[model samples]
Target: MRHSLPGGTLVLHPDELHDGEAGTEAGFRYRMIYVEPVVIQQILGGKPLPFIPTGLSTDPRLGLVLETFMQSIDAPLERLEEEDALFDLAQALDAVGNKRRGRRAYDYQAAERARDYIHASNGASITLDELEYVSGRDRWSLSRDFRALYGTSPYRYITLRRLDLARKMLLGGFNLVDAAMAAGFFDQSHMNRHFMRCYGLSPARWLSMLGRQTCTIVQE
Candidate 1:
């Protein structure tokens, strides 16, 4: 379940999923967006990531900053309100990661096709040969583009995306094997390997860490 939460109740971090039931439960609702940590730094008048002295989100100092942003979504007043909103979002994220003073080193656009193709196919075994067709670049060039743009090869990128989907599904209470299969992994082992690689922890351990219980749904 998810809703915009006045944009005030949001304690979002980049790439973090913010889910909750909306004000009135008309139906199951959700809102999904990627909030990058750098956006926060940008809003702090070009300030770098502040020294919050703690890495955990639950830190009271971090909580205060986040609470300020979430609880005051519509409070800031400015002529250029859009700009203010962007800045506000940045401030919120800066509570987590500091902005890189220099230009960001990642070319996020280069991986669009690769990302789309992977998601479109439900995380199938994506070969460079196939990506060449989808992205209109040769294998060698595609590999280069992926690494140069996203800091990882296409294969690794796909694997990571699969892991992301698996994590989301598991968090939503999907069975591990079913989540793996739905994410285009060959089987549970495939999901486990990628999950471990991406998280440095097993799927079950991840669930425990996240305080999620075993899923009841078993997709056929």
Candidate 2:
């Protein structure tokens, strides 16, 4: 978001789809953080977050904090260290308080409810209107609030959730086909397309490497 987002916000997996813009400005200044959901789960040691903190803004101070935490994630991190990253995040959120002004309470609540529903039905093909109905929100208001609260739209969230599940299945010794099914992808091809963009490798190759790692650990 354009307004200074309060710190301590945790954007969920990349598959989750988030956007950034300057608040209340013409021509919207834009920025985005691109990282894989697998990276986030890796950071969290392969655990799924039913919910992760997020929807922060880009302030100068937040910029520094974000850059530093990002630097530490040279590789997908383990779950234990996620707390370490969160420690730094807590400091940032304390700096930015809740309650974004010029935004209505109903609007904010509707967006949050919609996102929460998406999180609940991750990987399912839920329509935008469905999301709004469950959230007691209209499409236009939900769209804007969804962006502000979760940094992504209903459609994007479903896709990312699918991809995130796929990554987890891969790490769990599921083959490419299984991973795709598990993640709610239509097929290996579908999983492959998203995987290539997010992880820079084919699902088969990723599964192979993961398998080898598991084997090595078992041997040890």
Q: Taking the tens digit of each residue's C-alpha lDDT, what string does model 2 give over 10-118?
A: 4444366765555555544323344444444442334453232345444455566465346444534323223334433433443443422343454776777777787
Q: lDDT of model 1 at residue 200?
A: 91
In model 1, the clashing pairs are: 2-29, 2-30, 8-70, 14-35, 39-90, 40-90, 40-94, 49-98
TM-score between candidate 2 and the true structure: 0.45
lDDT of each: 0.57, 0.56
Residue 208 error for model 2, in Å?
4.1
Considering summed lDDT, which 10 consecutive residues are worst modelled in model 2?
211-220
Worst 10 residues of 1 by lDDT: 76-85
Query: For model 1, how does the per-residue alpha-carbon lDDT over 1-220 read when each residue is reduced to its tens digit?
Result: 3333332333443354534454775654433333455544433544654543232344344444343334335343222223334443454455445534444343345457766786787666655557667777544445545666766555666667778888888888789889988887777866786688677988988898878876534447
